[model samples]
Target: MFCYQCEQTAGGHGCTKMGVCGKQPETSDLQDLLIYLSKAISMYAWRAAELGFRKEEIDRYVVEALFTTVTNVNFDSERIVNFIKKGYNILAEARALYEKAASDQGRQPHKIEVIDSWNPPQTYEEMLAESQGIGIAARLSQLGDDVTGLQELITYGLKGMAAYADHAAILGISDPEVYKFIHEALNFLTADEGRDADALTAMALKVGEVNLRVMEMLDEANTGTYGHPEPTVVRVTPKKGKAILVSGHDLKDLAILLEQTKDKGINIYTHGEMLPCLAYPELKKYPHLAGNYGGAWQDQKKEFDEFPGAILMTTNCIQKPAETYKARIFTTGLVAWPGVTHIADKDFTPVIEAALAEEGFTEDAPEKTITIGFGRNAVMSVAPTVIDAVKAGKIRHFFLVGGCDGAKSGRNYYTEFAQKVPDDCVILTLACGKYRFNKLEFGDIGGIPRLLDIGQCNDAYSAIKIAGALAEAFDCGVNDLPLSIILSWYEQKAVCILLTLLHLGIKNMKLGPTLPAFVSPAVLNVLVENFNIAPIKTADEDLAEILG
Candidate 1:
């Protein structure tokens, strides 16, 4: 079980025995095998699509299967095995489609012996053993680190893209071209193209290209469903009532749960990435959709234990459930933990029951508040003001200091960096990383709040759109703006976003808490040369350079 896909991998390298996120080696191996099968399925799926046959269910399953393997998403080996078993069934249908398509075209299908004639072991134990042959470590020796690293880079980016794609699909928005690229990408991994450094690098950027579209699809799905987010202050203090805390990135699930729990004496509080949901017009109308509960995913163990009501993890970034609150914490939509309640089909009856059975806050905590909802639309609405302020030298610079937050040590760099920003600059942030100094005051520059939370990692499209607008306003490229991007990444969604930035030729961004272990030194050199990407220095040191 060699997993180095996240920033928290052991000793800044691979996790061999257990995951820093508490994933067991068995689960890790199973996830590896599941990805292998997905690639096999895609081998046929991609060919079938080329031959004019497509299956939406097969395409969607591949996306969800990849998302399930993302860091901290699914830890249940049984759940992963179920996906593997299901993949076998999907593979059969995909191959059948390819055969039918080829027959109608008056040609025989090309035989890819690697995936076509393969059969995986059936039992869980055998499946785990089979994973031994399919894991990334097995390929590292054969292909060498540089090529293998680039392949893994593409896979990681696809995992992030798959996550965002699934979210958009849940809201009834999707693009066949996105699915096509996904299958084409997974299929790319099964062939010789993955070993070419130049070809793999290009494929990685294409992953970014399509991911940009996926994020746009998600942005549209979210805003089209719920009206654009408005600048609104949220109650950070716990109210004196039964409550259900919803975490993870799925706004649709939260909305359904909000509708289910309305007037049932349960206040729905958003946690972590879900915090931005409070600003959406459609969701904010539910009076009981209370304020945010916690800061980010890493603090969930303590936060979940202390919360007196039910907790729901709607998507990724799930940790190993603690015994104290495992019973009350539920997971849905590709997130799973062993022995924890699993909510399927958007049902919240069990969650509501758990929330009511526990005592909520006995008394209202002191009224504390933080303003959220500074999405692209909200920020751009004040474009004239912001533009005028920047032009007048009232707003000196722009800093995008945001990405996935984790429990690593160097993450404090983001906090110190944000805190050290001068009074004249505006800091744009998104994802849970904003938790570092979000609650702290940055005050305002010319009536524009110095700290702007752009929404979840899913709202990166909003950030990109915001930058494009600023560039257009300034009559220059985004790179020419007085903006510095400092990102802290922990997971695959961040990977895809970084790829998007690289794809757009955005340069000189700082990325940490550490560079990915999967990126070989050669690949890192390429990034350094091409994009000027740098591992972060000390907060004071980095701040001095950026401002200078």
Candidate 2:
């Protein structure tokens, strides 16, 4: 089982023995098989679309199927096997639809086929090739060295896109075109005939384009429902008493939990990507919504253990559970684990019970607050003043510094970069990367805080909206604005967001803690030459470069 779909793939290549993310070999193979089945469904769905099937039920399955394959989303082999069964069921339904269409048209309906064309190994040589990195690379090489590489990259990007799309759909926001693009892209990856370098490259860019749309739809869904984020200081200090630490990027889930536990004796502390929830008026209005409790996702094993209250993971970036805190943890939505109590659709009772059993802090702890909420709407509310400050030379630079946070030590660059940015420059950040410097007090440029914490990783949507608006206000292209995107990526969600930036022709962005191990040098060159993408240097160096 060879997999290289994430930033931390073993040795910057494929993970052959087991996943660095704690995925077993069997789990990895099932994920690959799951993706293979999803592609078959995609092909059927695409054909049905071509034949004028409008009310496509296959679209929902397509989204869920792709989402299920994302890193850290599903590590349970049992659940994955179940999803494979579900995918087969979906494929059967799609085949029936295709057949019915053909029958109505007096022609032979195209039969849905699952192609597991991988060569079966009989000899030691063949078995070795199938098991080693060289063999896996060869199969990927068949996708055409360049074409396969690009398709793999885009497939990872779509994984991220599907995650964001799934989140938006939960909020009753659905984009049919985004669904169409996903189906088309998934089919393209699996198609035997049209898989070529040029075609795959085009598909890759198109994934980025659709990801941009999904992010936009999510931005609209979030800000429209929760109100735009604004600058508000959120305390990092834990309050005295029992608390529930909510992690990951599900605002609706967080909102529901916040509502349920508001008057109870329990306190709600935001963790990891949930840090930005402090900006939402509805969420922040809850007096029991205490300050942030931990750092980024990668630090959870240590931080979660130290915390006294329960923890809820609404999404990904969860490492393997530590024994000390495993039972106190609860998972919701797409997140699942064998031992942890999972909060299902109708009931959060388990989470409440866990919180009650944990027995939070006995007395009131020290009170502290850290400001958050600077989403697009909140930022745009002061656009006129921001423009004035820029004109007045009070705000010298605008840094769109955000992305996923990871365990890599190089990530300290982000913390230092944000710290070293001129006090005159306002730093706009989203995702877990904001955890690095959100606590820093950079003061304000005019009325705007020097550091603005946007929403979750999906809230990159908010950053994009703010950038587009700033471009319009400044009467220039987004690239020509005073903004610089210094991003740090950990998982596939970052992949999709970066692709969206590329699709939009945003240039000179700095991507680091590390470049994705999946990106071949040739593909990296294509990005650098075309999009001016660069890796991050030291804070002093990058600061000079961006400000220069």
Candidate 3:
């Protein structure tokens, strides 16, 4: 199917034959149909809301449906088909309400087409054509081409927003407004009229604004529930015996694993985005939570190859598993693979059993440590001191050098940028982008480490929080602060986060290593003129630009 919703879309255009992320043509077709059904459901929900329908009942379903379409999230065709059917069922219920209302008003009831009535593809070419057709049709017949592009942009932003919202929900936090915007925006995408480019542009900005709120809600949920992250040193060294490597960005899953494995003689190490989990007070309370195992998302195949214990992926960014580590790998939550054992909603018992079955390190591994726990709360507690240091020339500059990491060679710009920063400056990083140079010893400014590892990509929430607080302390706008955001993006999550930054009027940021393939030059011009966004240059050159 023709899908270009991600950075690795085939040939930087669209994945026509098959998804480079291991999604088959059939799976792509199903995902398209799922979106179609989700749009139909959104339409019904929107109408119901206008008629004073109970919207709360359908909130969670709206979040889940949007999240299911995110890049690299769900590849299971069977699971997607089930969701499509579920959406249809919900739409049917809403239709019944509409019919009753019309009959009571003495008017003829209108009929709605069943979601299942849409033609399913019989061949690969048909699937591809259908996929493109649906996207184009949504843009033309519903949202005109430009508005369609903007709506899709906002929809993708909402997908990221829903993922974060879901994470907060797991932590027992809920924001009705976040869900409200998501539902409204999804409905707008499906609307037959009032879908002009200007209107969609306004909605796109609104999505970004609401996303900021969602991120704040999640940040509060995480820090308030788990205690703010604190600076703690984690080791990069792996032990010789049985060790289990945990990856992805879910702190709750990591916390449970740490709790269950306490005093069980099994060593736990953080991997990927989980590398920053060591900063959270509630999670770090466990004594056996070992050091980090590997670098970023791109390095997993090689790193997982020699890992001696079972590896658990709690979320996305999982590449094709190597044969050697296939049996040792496990997936949870929305992440799934064909042969991998998926830990379901009820329990992670199977994953724990597998970890236990594989005997951990035979001997105590060498003690090595890497510093973590530099999220917003931890940083804000010391904001006044940071401001004083900046003024006194002890901390000359602040660099936000983070974003998604990928296989592209140009990503080395991040490593070099981190390396070239003045000794007096501090580097703040989050997401997989930090893997480029997290291992480098940037030394300390006073007691604070020069390089701070904020949480995951979503933890951009933390970075934003810290920036705003710092701006407040300095009695100036956030853009007036010493910090500069040098970001590398490879996915839609990054797109949403960047949009949030732009929506907040944050300017003069550097984005790289390559521009998004989906951004038409016209749209790019608007971003450049309005946001002052630029691609990353050589480290020395960028350093001069920022420091000068």
Which candidate achieves the best lDDT against the true structure? Answer: 1
By summed lDDT, which 10 consecutive residues of candidate 1 come out lowest?
A: 112-121
Per-residue lDDT over 27-61 for candidate 1, one digit per residue giving the tens place of the 0 to 100 score: 99999989998998899989988877899989998
Give a tens-digit lDDT track for model 2, residues 196-313: 7667667778888889889888887787788777678778888787889998888999989987786778999988888878878777888888788888888999999988888899
Tens digits of lDDT, candidate 3, 356-472: 787666765677677778887778888778888988889988999998888866888898889989999999989988888888888888887899888788688889878888888
Comparison by TM-score, 1 against 3, better one? 1
For model 3 the TM-score comes to 0.91
The local lDDT score (0 to 100) that residue 409 gets in candidate 2 is 69
lDDT of each: 0.92, 0.79, 0.77
Candidate number with the higher lDDT (1 or 2): 1
| Each model's Cα RMSD | 0.9, 3.5, 3.2
Off-target runs (Cα >4 Å) in candidate 3 are 50-52, 55-57, 96-132, 136-148, 192-195
Instruction: Give candidate 1 regions above 4 Å deviation.
Output: none
**lDDT of model number 2:** 0.79
Each candidate structure's TM-score, on Cα atoms with residue i matched to residue i, is 0.99, 0.93, 0.91
